[model samples]
Target: MSSQQQEKYEESELYRIRHSAAHIMAQAVMEMFEPGEAQIAIGPPIEDGFYYDFDLPRPLTPEDLVAIEKRMRQIIAGQHKFEKKAVSAEEAKAMFADQPYKIELIEGLETGGVDEYGEPLDEKPEISFYSHDAFTDLCRGPHVEHTGKINPSAIKLLHIAGAYWRGDEKRPMLQRIYGTAWKNKDELEAHLGRLEEAKKRDHRRLGKELDLFSVSPDVGSGLILWHPKGALVRHLAEEFCKDEHLANGYDFVYSPHIGRGQLWEKSGHLKWYQENMYSPLDIEGNEYYLKPMNCPFHIEIFKSRVRSYRDLPMRFAEWGTVYRYERSGVLHGLMRVRGFTQDDAHLFCREDQMPEEIDRVLDFCLHLLRGFGMNEFKAYLSTRDPQKSAGDTQRWDDATEALRAALDRVGLDYEVDEGGAAFYGPKIDLKMIDALGREWQLSTIQFDFNLPERFELIYIGEDGERRQPYMIHRALLGSMERFMGVLIEHYGGAFPLWLAPVQAIVIPIADRHIPYAEEVAARMEAAGLRVEVDARGDRMNAKIRDAQNQKIPFMLVVGDHEVENNVVAPRLRSEERLDALRVEDLIGRMQKDIEDRM
Candidate 1:
């Protein structure tokens, strides 16, 4: 096969393997349950694995998973050949009469509707079934010729969880069996190892253990309550970003959390983004909404006064907090939240300055991300989706080329996402690869032509003609809550010296040394270090352990010898100890690290 053909064959193989694995798992599940006791729903191949949903008579347990997995291996060993046969919708319905979910799917296929998995057939296509031995399922197949082709040892069922049918809460809840299938056992083992490491570094667990944040039942779901330490870290991050923005020629701006319905309607947010927005609240006689984005507010700032070309490249920055409605099932700790503060900014520049501005913004994004220890970067240029976009074709092409040129000028690697742009215009999305080789999208520079036109925003040029300046929307850190969550997991809660909530802790060897430790902490604090003196009556080792648990970068141990000499024995979190150093010397070292953003 040619290279392209070979690539397609390999992809088809993996898809077939995963798709076949789901069927085998479903068959095993049916065998384990009593006749007519379990009804199989949709089984689909997703990223990294496959999952099959079933409406079981009872909740699945760990022991049940083991049993189902054992039976699946037995079925694989039987070496059943997969047989495909097309059937009319009427025949499919009759064949799956006992299975309500399958019957529902057949009905959808007959009526040219969407199935529970969201697979829609606008015009009814041929319905088919794939059968292996006595087990069969409605499907469109490109499956392995036989079950013997599967490597049973390379596949394992991971876990079982509750899922609502079609992802709708109102629908019947089903048991979803999540499993991973690989071409070989080694790859399976590697994937399992990554899962273990990911679990250990799970931000939700670290958040609670480190006392950084909490999501309480009383506070409602998808809402985060940053603890004191977490709040300090968040505030420090915002302060650093604000300082950077100011230095980069951005004017700080503020807007209310709620705006009148008319504001959203004028911005086209109500028409285009209403599904993600929260229901409007009625105040007096008008409707108000919790702002889902800060773009419209920044646009209002741009329109506050008419301007000549002198103010063409106006940058407005805000650490604006916004709210949106998220389904309960998808709300992860801080990674996905209902309310978050976006490091949002907008740049309005003349068309002549558009290319240069794009280049500058891309460079600035890389610089800011590097300061956070995210140096590896790649960008995706999302061009306008022809069917959904609103702007004229020429403007879209120009904006897309500007973004591409910006990436090329910076010598950055990028891929084009042909139709990934928002409805308004094209955009460039930057993804940062973290310490674990996981990619996180942290910055976006989007071009908008539709909004300015909708709002009738115009600036007078030197030629005395009203011209619509190109509007660029940028979010550097994406959102405070999500970024903090990523940061917590990125460093595994052992933040670098500059970003650690408590940079150092002073530990006294005894009660007599308490005053000296406090003095040491005071000196460090005066030097702008975040230091705390551990004054508890606990043993010295216990205090050190507590500081380590808190991931404090430096632990300053002050004994009589050190105190008398006005020095501290510095202990690093990595368990490295240094000889007694003068307080001034230690502070200077810390100051250097902070300056370097270590």
Candidate 2:
């Protein structure tokens, strides 16, 4: 097979194997626990693994995982044939009679194939079911021909946790079991290695170890309390972004945290995003809401004045804080949160300026990612879906074609997601791959035809007539909290010189060398470096170990020998290599690095 075909074949084979593994896992859980005690919901393949959500009588323990694995191995030995039979909606409903979630799914399939809790989709002609022996699921599936093709040893159940059905807190809470399956033992081992590496760099653990930030129980879930160290890092990140934006011709703008409900109605957010928003508060008999997005505020600023085409392609940026209600089950340490600041911007331009403006934004996005030492990226241009979105087909085609033209002009390759655009318009999303090969959505440039229409925003063209100007909503570092989480994992808590909370730690070789260490630290600080002197009376080895554990970028040892020479010993995070340098020379180098933001 050709390389492209080979990739497709491998993906197909892996999906079949992983999906089958999910079923076997569900069966294994059934065998271990009593019927009705453990109920299974949808189990599908994610990026690297499959997760099956279930509702069980008791929480699964580590011992339970061991027992469940044995049961899975026995089933794999049986090698039951997976018989996929297509059935009608009624038949599917009957087959899943005992499973309410499945029955709801069946009802949804019959009624335009929408999920139970989803907004309804337009009618489609055909929807079917797939069955594997006694376990029949309401899924539009393309499973493996049989379970015998799956390598049992390549599958391993990782952990168990809770997830809300359909990711809605109002829905039933279910147990989510995560597992990974690969085509061969070697691939499985590689995947396990990545997972282990990810665990080592998990931001939550690193946050505690480095004394950066915390999510205290008293502070509530999904909310971060940034300690001094974390705040310093965040402030530096914001300053860097601000400086870059200023240089790139972006005007800084700020808006209120709360806005009247009428503002959302004018922006159409009240119609589409009300569910994700907190309940409005009645302020003096008027409804007010915490701002869920900065687009409306930016639009208001644009509408504050009437302008000719001379002001075309105006860019306004804000580090605006927004609040959205997130389900507690999906609440992670900092990745998913209730409130966060977005590095948001809005670009207003004439129709003729779309292509160049998009190219400029793409270039800016690339630079921003590179500023954080990220280079590998995947770009996708998403167009509207006729069934889900509200827009004329002609407009969507024009917007999508415009985005494609922009990418082509910039010579940036991107995938086209045919039906993945927002209800308003098409968008180009950029996902950056971190050290662990995990992708994070760091930047997005989306066209907003709907918002301009809703807000009735217009500008006087060269023809002396008012015309609707195009709006682009862009967010680099989508959320400050989430981006910080990504940064922590990417750097393994060892940030580069520009981003480190404490760039250098001055350690005395012995108790008698404290004064010299303080002097060295003062000199570094005066040079605009974040420096700390370890005067804790700990042993040199212990201090070095602590610094290493915290992932400090540079450790400086000041001793009698070095003090007499007016020099300091430097150890970098890259290696165990050390060098002796004069204090002045070290300060100059450090200052240069900080200035370069390297």
* All-Cα superposition RMSD per candidate: 4.9, 5.0
Evaluated with TM-score, which candidate comes out highest?
1
lDDT of each: 0.88, 0.82
| Off by more than 4 A, model 1 | 1-23, 33-48, 53-63, 76-155, 161-175, 181-193, 279-284, 376-378, 431-441
Worst 10-residue stretch by lDDT in candidate 1?
A: 431-440
Clash count per candidate: 0, 1
Which pairs clash (backbone N, Cα, C closer than 3 Å) in model 2?
54-175
lDDT of each residue in 1-598, candidate 2, tens digit only: 7776567643677887887778877877766667666667888877677878887888889888888777777777776777656677787777767778877766776775575445465764345655554565555556777666677778888888888998898988888888888888889899898878888888888889888999878978888999999999999988988999999989999999999999998887788899889999999999999999999999999999996898988898999999999988778777889989999999999878877787788888778878988766788999888777764567667768877887787677799988898888899988866545666787888988788888888999999999888889999888899889888887889888999998989989988888899888888788788899888978988998888887788899888899889899998767574679988898888888877877
How good is model 1 by TM-score?
0.82
TM-score of 2: 0.81
TM-score of each: 0.82, 0.81
lDDT of 2 at 130: 59
